[model samples]
Target: MFKLPELDYEYGALSPAISADIMQLHHSKHHQTYVDKLNAALEKYPDLQNQPIEDLLQTLDELPEDIRTAVRNNGGGHYNHSLFWKVMTPGGSQPTTELLGKINQEYGDLETFKSNFTQAALGVFGSGWVWLLPDMSITTTPNQDSPISEGVVPLLGLDVWEHAYYLDYKNVRPDYIKAWWGVVNWSKVSELAQKS
Candidate 1:
């Protein structure tokens, strides 16, 4: 069965950018619902339960039709939220040399990359995610869709879902996006990028 992963820091650690209330609700409530639903969805397919959530998402078409959608939504939620937690830290960290070099090569400079990424996040029509792909490309996926579904690994992801920022930034998504950068765990993102 799937389970919500424990955060590396306290719920209030990401405050100012992401509030303690938002963190508690997002992780313990929202993310936990995803885990519960995903596990419930797989109850009839015990064999599939042992498979990694990433594998399930990557091979959704191969799953039985009866439970495919459930797994896709809930499983994608599981994977996305899991990465979301890890990609952020209390005070944040700088990108490693390799990751910074690639970001510069692909986007000309870090500021340009941030601008592009922020724009992409804003462009998302509704609840979705903006991801930095392994190739250093920026992409957006609607709803719970993950980059793995498109055959690419995500190095970094920003959740633009209303639930992610409504309490803190209200209707100003741009403000939330800007504050979010302050908490990005670049070290973890760089590790993921280098591994890819």
Candidate 2:
């Protein structure tokens, strides 16, 4: 069964930028729901149970029609949230030289990349995510969809779903996006980028 992964840091670790209250609810409540639902959806499909989430997402069209949507939504949710927690840290970290080099190559400079990524995050009309692809390109997906579905690996991603920041930032998504940078685990992102 899919499960909610434990966060590396305490809920309050990402304070000021993302409050303890938000982290607790986001991780314990929201993410747990996804894992539960995904497990429930797969209960009758034991043949698919052993496949990794990535494989399921990549071959979504081949899944049984009755459970495809459930797996796509909940499975994507599980995968996305798992990675989300890892991409953030208490104090965060600066971009490594290799990661910065790629960012500069693709988006001119770090600030420009931030501007582009923030714009992509804001551009999402509703519950979704903005991902920095392994190729250094940016993309957004609606609902619980992931770039992995498109055969692209995500190096980093920002969750723009209301449940992610509504309690803390209310209606100001840009503020939430701005503050989110303060907790981004650049080292983790860099490691993912380097693998690409």
Candidate 3:
């Protein structure tokens, strides 16, 4: 059975950008639901339990039809949130020199990249995510969808679902996105980018 990963830091660590209350709910309550549901779905096909969430998501169409959607949504949720927690820090840091060079090569500069990425985040119509792909491309995934399903992995992703920011920033998703930048874990992004 799949399980919810423990956070590397305490819930309150991301305060100011993401509140303790919001983190608690988003992690313990929201993420836990995804883990539970994914586990239940895998129970129907015990052999599939051995595969990682990423594998389950990337091969959704190949899964048994009866449990395909459950695995897609909940398994995607598990993978996304797991990466989400790791790609954030209490006080954000600048991208690694290598990542910075790559950002410059693609977007011309970091500020421009942030502006473009922010616009993409704001453009998401409803519950979804804005991702920075390994190629330095910006993209969005609706609902519990993941970039891995398309054969590309996200280096960094911003969760735009209301459950992610509602308690703190309310209806203003832009504010949440703005605040989110302050806690971004660029080193993790750099590592992921290197692997990508």
Candidate 4:
């Protein structure tokens, strides 16, 4: 069974950008529910135990039809949220030389890339995510859906789900998106970018 992963930093570490209350609730509550439901769904299928989250996503079509949707929803939530926690830090970090250079080549400058990414995030009318792919492309996915389901590994992703920011920023998604940049784990992004 999958478990909710512990964060590298304290819940209060991302203050101002993201409140401690929001982080605690989001991680302990919302994320925990996903893990619980995922384990319950997989309980009947002993053969599926201990599979890597990515492999489970990729092979969803091959799972028993009865439990496929549960796995897709909760498992995707688990996977996405796991990545989300890792790609954030207390004060954020500077982008590595190679990652910044790649962004410059692809989008002309860092600010331009950020503008496009933010716009993509805002374009999500409902709950979804905006991702920065390894190739420097930006994309969005609805609900807990991930680019990895289609075999595309994203280098970074921003959750636009209301639960992610409603308490702190209320209905102002743009404000949340803007503040999120300050806590982004750019060094982790750099590592993912280079790995792909």
lDDT of 2 by residue, 1-196 (tens): 7778999999999999999999999999999999999999999999988889999999999999999999999999999999999999998888899999989999999999999999999999989999999878899999999988888879898999999999999989999999999899999999988887
- lDDT, each prediction: 0.93, 0.93, 0.92, 0.93
**Each prediction's RMSD to truth:** 0.7, 0.7, 0.7, 0.7
Candidate 1 stretches with Cα past 4 Å from truth are none
lDDT of 4 by residue, 95-156 (tens): 99999999999999989999999999999989989999988999999999998899888889
RMSD over all Cα atoms, model 3: 0.7
Name the regions of candidate 3 deviating beyond 4 angstroms. none
- By summed lDDT, the worst window of 10 consecutive residues in model 1 runs over 148-157
Clash count list over all predictions: 0, 0, 0, 0
Question: Judged by lDDT against the true structure, how good is candidate 2?
Answer: 0.93
For model 4, name the residue pairs that clash: none
For candidate 3, lDDT tens digit of each residue in 1-196?
Answer: 8888999899999999999999999999999999999999888798999997778888899999999999888988999999999999989877999999999999999999999999999999989999999888999999989999988889999999999999998899989999999999999999999999
Q: How high is each candidate's TM-score?
A: 0.98, 0.98, 0.98, 0.98
What's the C-alpha lDDT at position 148 in model 2? 84
Candidate 1 lDDT by residue in tens digits, 78-99 = 9999999999998989999889
